[model samples]
Target: MAKTIQCTVVTPERKALDQTVDFVVLPLYDGEIGIAPDHAPLIGRLGYGEMRLRRGAEVSRFYVDGGFVQVVGNHITVLTAQAVPADDIDREAAQQQLDAARGQPASTDEQRQIRDRTVAQARGRLRVARQAHP
Candidate 1:
């Protein structure tokens, strides 16, 4: 049998996941990184993308806006600024948000920041849903 490690994903609103998995693949600020059982302890900053968990034949995915990840022993903990399980995302709503954000006229720096965040959120949602169902 394959060995697994504990993985917990938390966002400001709630703890989205707490499970055991053979490995985890996360989108770090720099790039994608994989974590496995007994992985060396480390910490990393995450970016907008999908977190993929693999255990046996089952695989799950989630979207994270940005966060930090800590790995120690046989456990990985993710503290995210924002996160959503793929199943919880509404594709139509995400698309609408993306469209609305894009349609807004360029203005102040605050508007740019909002646009950027909205785009990132939409991308993360798309990434998670694609990976989860594909």
Candidate 2:
């Protein structure tokens, strides 16, 4: 049997997930990072993308936006602004958000940055959902 580690995912509204997972892939600010049992302790800023957790043959996916991850001992905790399961994501709604973000005109740098982040988050949700289906 594969070894497992404690994994917890939380958002401002609620606790999204808490379980023992054999492996996990997180979306870091720079890129993706994979962790397993006994991984070195660390902390990192997260980005907009899919967070994948696996146990045996089953895989779970979530879309996370702008968070922080902490790894200590054999436990992994993710604190995110938002987290949505891939199966719960609405493709049409995500597409609409992406379109709206792209269509909006940004008058200032702050507006542009927010718009860009919104677009990225919407795209990430769509991507995760599509990947799960396809």
Model 1 agreement with the true structure over 20-90: per-residue lDDT tens digits:
99989999988999998989999999988888899888878788888899998998999998767788877
Give the runs in model 2 whose Cα sits over 4 Å from its true position.
none
lDDT comparing candidate 2 with the true structure: 0.90
Q: What TM-score fits each model?
A: 0.85, 0.94
Which regions of candidate 1 are displaced past 4 Å? Answer: none
Model 2 vs. true fold: TM: 0.94
- Choose the strongest candidate by TM-score: 2
lDDT of each model, Cα atoms only? 0.84, 0.90
Flag clash pairs in model 2. Answer: none
lDDT of 2 by residue, 1-134 (tens): 66789999999999989999999999998999999999999999998989999998999999998799999988999999988888988788878888988987889999999888888888888888788677
Name the lDDT value of residue 11 in candidate 1.
Answer: 84
